[model samples]
Target: MKNTIAERIFDFLKDFPPFDVLTAEQLIIIARNVKVIYLPKDKFVFKIEEEIHDHFYVVKDGAIGIFRKEDQVLVDECDEGDIFGLRAMIRKGNYILSAKAIEESIVYSISSLLLEEIIQTNTEANKFLIASFATNTRNPYANDNKGTLFANVKSLQKNESSLTEVQSAQYSKNPITCQLKTSIQQAALIMSTKHVGSIVITENQKPIGIITDKDLRLHIATGRFSIDDPVESIMSSPVITYPENISVAEAQIAMLQHKITHLCITKDGTANSVLTGILSEHDIVAIRGNNPSALIKEVKRAKTAETLQHIRKKVQQLLQGYVEQHIPISYISKVISAINEAITQRAILLSLEEMNTPPPVKFSWLALGSQGRKEQLLITDQDNALVFENPPKEQFDVTKAYFLSLSEKVTQKLNTIGFEFCPADMMASNPRWCLSLDEWKNQFHSWITKPDKDKILLSMIFFDYEMIYGDKNLVDEMSESIFGSIGSYKIFLNFMGLNALKNPPPLSFFRQFLVEHSGEHKDQFDIKARAIMPLVDAARLLILSNNLKGFNSTIARYKKLAEVEPQNKDLYESCINAFRVLLRFRTQQGLKNNTSGRFIDLKSLSKADRLKLKGCFKPIKDIQELIKVRFSLSHML
Candidate 1:
């Protein structure tokens, strides 16, 4: 029962990941199930499309070269502690890559079933083993996969378990309120002072009407009505009411169906009942993070900017966990975007409170640049703008002033929360960027029509905007306006394609990493400029030229491109894989150095990591060539 050889395998695996993160008791369960085999140098472990072993392999000694069966060129070299054969376990697809021993090897073949049990919650292991071909390096213990990494991830497990959507959710006990007799000034004073988004207008402890931030902004702040008017005058009558014991799922569906944020909670489930509490999107967002639903819950309850800042840090940990667990890039983007947008929404509400007044006009907060693309992985400089519904000409200055004041507070709080201010002052607080819907539309048209280098550069960044919070209709119309402009002036796509080609393929003729030449980043590899941006630019331009909409993510764009242009599927697929690795590499560097992961120190990378980096460049080169051919840019070049 002792099995000395198996014990030795356990000892080695325990020192590495999913295993390292596991307990001795847990490792014992796994170590007992492993199958050890000897592989002499140049001998094959498994041939391509060979029947996959029920177990995955880990190297105990020597290195294994994983080769594409087609060309037989080694794609990755796995040394001690590296994993292989995981994809086969997951996909049961015939081995796409063959593994061979480059030197005499002692391999521990781990029972896939055993790993599934022992590290069931070990997302770190799941992330580590997500893609077998991804293992060019030694260990995958760097990030918390939060137990979502493996085949047993059970995508809906959290929903089935943690979210008892039928069970009554905890509602706010102390509901903020205003009486019908209350003046608009009194109501605004109450809302601003208490920092609530809405006030239930009640009579005889029964919900009668409601006034929200939106109501205040549209009806009074824009000079539509005087502050002296009774709150009832502008209140949305017959307040949407729910019972105090309503389920989280019910609350969400109701909010969506009614197109409302605040729902009045009553002693009974109907509008005729006595007001007991209020549920809002704020309440739903605060449902708790045992699941994704719970994660947003913490984001919702962040009372102070500092609290939201703290949540932002937690979001980073979650992000790192997702990356570590090898979650799909698309899913990761959606999760992070939810967290990010929630934070921005919370901050915006808080900012409104700080201003002692509601927004002067209906407005939306738009996240620009990378955030717009929803591809933001690491915290970077804030690129944002404010777009408001245009006010009457006489009230424009006062309206702009109110929004500018709110933006200043929000941006400062966001800065405190760790999103650094945009060095170029392209934030909502900047008058140049903050504009009426008409103004933003005109600015976008100018950028498209002019086609000058400065304007083109602006267009590249400004065009991919996504609304973080506020009015969705405003953003939709603005997007419509932008596409209309692009439709008429189609030459802009050519200009954009030209601009996207600014950063050439990331390798020299020698296949070396093309690093920066001088300035603050001398001798450093500018991964963002040379590697990441090229793909980002390519994806954006491709989508734009095709007149596609709603795909802001680079990975999504690439995935779509592969779908529409099936001829380029392999190329797009390769680009996606490469992009994932490069992005992960950048994040690792950024987390390690406490700086942006843009400038990588090539000397710091191991030979294996360097090889992996090189592997990712091929797709970049191929994509650029495609772009050049598609745009007919040989003459321009």
Candidate 2:
């Protein structure tokens, strides 16, 4: 007899991992025993501490969020072709985390018997499963045990490795140590001679206290303690200690939890045992090459635009590694943005030094568009503006001229450092963008009161303004001016809503990508204009209408929206996830082809890649509908 349902399940499973490696006979056998289950939004598939089910689940459609029981924080979100509830089944233990439907979802549950008999015996499939366990469990050590079958599973193709998180942290074996009775002066001498930031105080080879550069600055330099005083007077007692076998993640967590920068590696992972080595924050940063803190420090020390340019290249390499390693896009974006901001800040300082004299008045430099939102991953065109304190009517020209000259120098330095000048001349160097505080308020008022196509476009970019240098109060005042104008006019948000819907979801009736019909990107997909911008625009409009402030990035805005409007939390969360996927997809594509990643050739995508791209469009369409109804954009459109 024909088992059509089983055949359908087999078809879907064959496209995903583990099952993808399974033979036709083996997959069909597992699929035959699969049972389909449907869940509405917020419904629980299994609760924490529940007995392990006979089966584990694979998502067929929609999303499932795995939540930690204590905090209810969503740890991992499983989507199409994603497997869940399997870790408990594999361990034969009760569920440690709860699985809930994030939206209307269909999941296929396969018996543990089939998993043990068919999939577990296969080497490739077993490796993939172990990798999945490592990722979903958030356990850095799961794949680190060399004696376990899971060891080296990170080498599997397309598997997300914990990378530095799981690797055994390298510590300085020859730690600089001082006796508990050593004077502060002698300890300081030892630290300087060894070129180390800290020194541990030990008794019988066991760490009892630690002193760092911070201690010297606070205790001796501040005249709080004499340099001749014993180290015990200033040393922080009960030194934080870790095992020699500690992983980077464990060391980092211990540091954060204890509020310390150095960890004493001991023989038995306790301060009671012999101190074997020392691990500092700098060591961890060194392990993760292109670390944000190290990059920022380099940026500060950089003397020329050329030096900054070199650092920016390192930033690109870091981004590539993060993309390939499957790091969370949110974390990657923050790190990259911080480095970019530091570079920009350094550029401004260099430009200021070249000026004939100090600025005549206080001013703020604003980063517009993607940089403003802290979402820039690639070195793209610079969008910036400058706002100085309102000048005296008699001295307006002189004040404006001084800032314009300064702006010109800053923009040139930035361009030299690889941020190409904005093609449209929407830069601080342009007189139109270099304005007084009052002038900027009036400019914003004009755009908000009389909404038009060009103004809407400018608003989309300029409204996400973030101050890179100068008075944050000025930016805060500017924000107030913008909201005040919107509150008065009330129709600007509706206009913004209409603009957000201009680029419909990048899918057609047949569920195929809608590629560009003409132009330089003819027959290619515009991921940015079609997919990314819609989500960005929607978040901006919704957040602006709510009169909220300080939420800049699309992800941050959506997260805030989810918190404020819990009724629509699912929709907002979906938007957040979809935006992340689209952003990561664009960045990966950009890194691959060395272009802006806006246009993608459909032919180059694999079946799995295409499906992943398609998954993002649903949230885009749903959010557009919500905007249309909420802002009454239906009639306006």
List the global CA lDDT of all models: 0.77, 0.84
lDDT of 2 by residue, 1-637 (tens): 1659988898888877668777888998988888999999899999988998998888888888887643265656677777788778867889988899988999999887887787556887777666656553332333221111222333554433346655688999999999978999999999999999999999999999999999999999999999999999999998888778777655655564475789999996788999999999899887875555567779999999999999999888767766654446787787788789989999999999999899898999999999999899988999999999998899999999999999999999899989999999999999999999999999999999988999989988999889999988888899999999999999889899999999999988888799988998899999999999999999999999888999999999999999999999989988998898888888988888998888999898766678888889989999999999998878877
User: Which residue pairs collide, candidate 2?
Assistant: none
The Cα error of candidate 1 at residue 306, in Å, is: 1.1
- Mark the regions of model 1 whose C-alpha exceeds 4 Å error after superposition: 1-82, 86-292
Tens-digit per-residue lDDT, 1-637, candidate 1 = 3658668767677655557667788788888878888998888888887888888888776668787633355556565567777877777678867899876788888888888786567765665555333432222333321111222222312223223333466777788988898999999999999998888898888889999999989999799999999998999988887666666545654664576777888875577878888887766666634334455677787789899888888777656544554444555666677778888889998888777777878999999988898877789999999999999999999999988988999999999989999998989999998899999999999998888999988888887788888999999898889889999998888888888889888888988888878999898999998888889899999988777888887898899999999999878877887787777778767767778788989998755457667767878889989988998887997
Tell me how candidate 1 scores on lDDT: 0.77
Alpha carbon deviation, residue 304, candidate 2 (Å): 1.7
Looking at model 1, residue 401 earns an lDDT score of 91
For this target, which candidate reaches the highest lDDT against the unseen true structure?
A: 2
The TM-score obtained by model 1 is: 0.61
> Over the full model, what C-alpha lDDT does candidate 2 score relative to the true structure?
0.84
